[model samples]
Target: MSEHDFHVHGPHDHELEHAAQHEPKGFAGQLAVITAILATVGAFFSYMGGATQANAALLKNEAAIRKTEASNQWNYYQSKGNKQNMAELAAELVSSEEQRTKYRDKVARYDKEKADIKLKAEALEAASAQADEESAHQMHLHHRWAQATTALQVAIALAAIALLTRRRWMEWGTLAMGGVGVVLGGMAWLQL
Candidate 1:
């Protein structure tokens, strides 16, 4: 036969090549791809929820610090008695009282801010929890995916062994497994 004829009629010709490429994958590879995708989504929602909770805690701490500073200033003025220094002490008292009033107002504003933060944090936390629940379902999917992936890998290896030993069936199985692996890996990456 001519070289071109040999090429066209070869055992590994176009029809066989197309058939090998289009073969169905085993169960294991499909499961692994699904799980990896779910994990990526879960991690994202968890991070956002944690950030909101942290911000609320910080606002609460700031408000407490301001209240403490105002109280300390008032105490310092009171500690200095009202004898011959009564006028100066009186002026000091007025100044201290004004400072206390300003701080009190600030404290109120801070309290409102803190409350708002808490509300936001709670909402975020709820959202995070929902994400976590969804992830749990995904975990099961991951297990199935992993199992399928492992099985396909094993099948591919077996197919390689079969081909090396000149077994036709093994070659076909290997080709099938390879396709499965590629699809699963692609799916896993897309999940991210």
Candidate 2:
């Protein structure tokens, strides 16, 4: 891309503004300046909002996968518990001493297996919670960005009216709207 793309009016943006400072205050100049600044800020907010929303979606998906894994582990742990219970019952019912000893051994094995499964399930749940928290934070960022975008859009619309009517109050109203957008954009950056 050309260097001109970086500035609203190529390399002459500063020069143009300096020249405009010496010229008479008029609707045309004011409209040009305000519209340019608003467009630049609006573009930045749009890009940031898109990136944040994408990150949120990815985190949400990760959380869902972790939750599913946690659920599967819990189910496996329950199955192990059932096996342990059945083994205990078998030990009580069997008449032969050798068979009773085997059932008691099986019960011990299931108990050990259940302990491991429970740990795995708990770890997965923790991971899911972390992912969910991050996803929620990203969603909050997106909300601020959305509000900023709306304000910027309104400012742009007001700027158009100010240009058409050459009304100073309309220009001030447009500036106020842009201020709101900037504040919201800053809030999104702070993420607090």
Candidate 3:
């Protein structure tokens, strides 16, 4: 061909050119862009959901460990009580005054140790409760993120249907669903 008549078209160029001329200008492009944006947001929400779930599990594990430690401390406190009881009995049964005084001293020491053990056990129990509460909160956030992801997925599906059916109302529905997804994601971020 002469340079004046020379032309080049890629495989889809003719089809795209014809479509651009026949279809409503920018409608397909707008839908494609919006769908892409929604997909990206959905991916982020999905990731947040997974992260929150993992955090909840970890917090729950921490709570369990703390609870176990508290149990152990309480057991130790009970052992000290038993020792104090044995010393009190020994003091009562002793014949010598000097031996009785020694048993009393032992009993007093065991009482003090039991008090310290009791305080530690209580503290650990409080910590375990706090961690358990935090874990529950994380699970709540995870649920929010999961809901947001589901809404975005629904929006993406609606976009696909709108494209296939060429329905304007479907496009509006897609936008509404996407907006709901964004709101849920925001709520998740705010821990509400």
Candidate 4:
């Protein structure tokens, strides 16, 4: 070969250019970008799942505390009942009219107090039940978010495999998994 022809045609450019042309057409690169986006979405779903679980736990604790308070109030009601019974028995045994009147007055006060305590305890127990219901609802929400996160993670894995294998079927698999993730996330968002 002539020196002029050698200078015009370099060895490095043609071989590399030929190989570059044979590579897949931007499929892996696009898949990589999509996988990254899906991973970000997965993180969001994971965060929501964890947060909802924590909220549910907090609500459950609140319910327990309210229940304990109700129990304490009921015990107080029992003590008040015992006091009223004792006063009625003493009034029966007393000879002085004034002493009997005083004991009767005490019975009335104790009865009124017990009625208020019973009402308050019942209200607190109802509130505890409501909190338990709310906690269960939050737990359901958490489960939905967890399912969405799992689907998203699977989609991300499928996308990575699609990028590595460059198989069109794998791309479809990734799309299907991503669709499932999106549907689950929508259900969570709608609280359904």
Provide the global lDDT of candidate 4 against the true structure. 0.91
Q: Cα miss at 126, model 2 (Å)?
A: 1.7
Candidate 1 accuracy as TM-score: 0.32
Relative to the unseen true structure, what is the C-alpha lDDT of residue 151 in candidate 2, on a scale of 0 to 100? 96
Which lDDT values do the candidates have, in the order given? 0.49, 0.92, 0.95, 0.91
Superposition TM-score, candidate 2 onto the true structure = 0.84
Candidate 3's C-alpha runs over 4 A off are 1-22
Candidate 2 overall lDDT versus native: 0.92
TM-score per candidate: 0.32, 0.84, 0.90, 0.88
* Weakest 10 consecutive residues of candidate 4 by summed lDDT: 1-10
- Give a tens-digit lDDT track for model 4, residues 72-119: 999999999999999999999999999999999999999999999999
Best by lDDT: 3
Q: How far is candidate 1 from the true structure (C-alpha RMSD, Å)?
A: 13.5
Best TM-score among the predictions, by candidate number: 3
User: Candidate 1's error at 130, in angstroms?
Assistant: 6.6
Residue ranges of candidate 2 with Cα displaced over 4 Å: 1-24
The lDDT of model 1 is 0.49
Q: Which run of 10 residues does model 2 get worst, by summed lDDT?
A: 3-12
- Per-residue lDDT of model 3, residues 52-82, tens digit only: 9999999999999999999999999999999
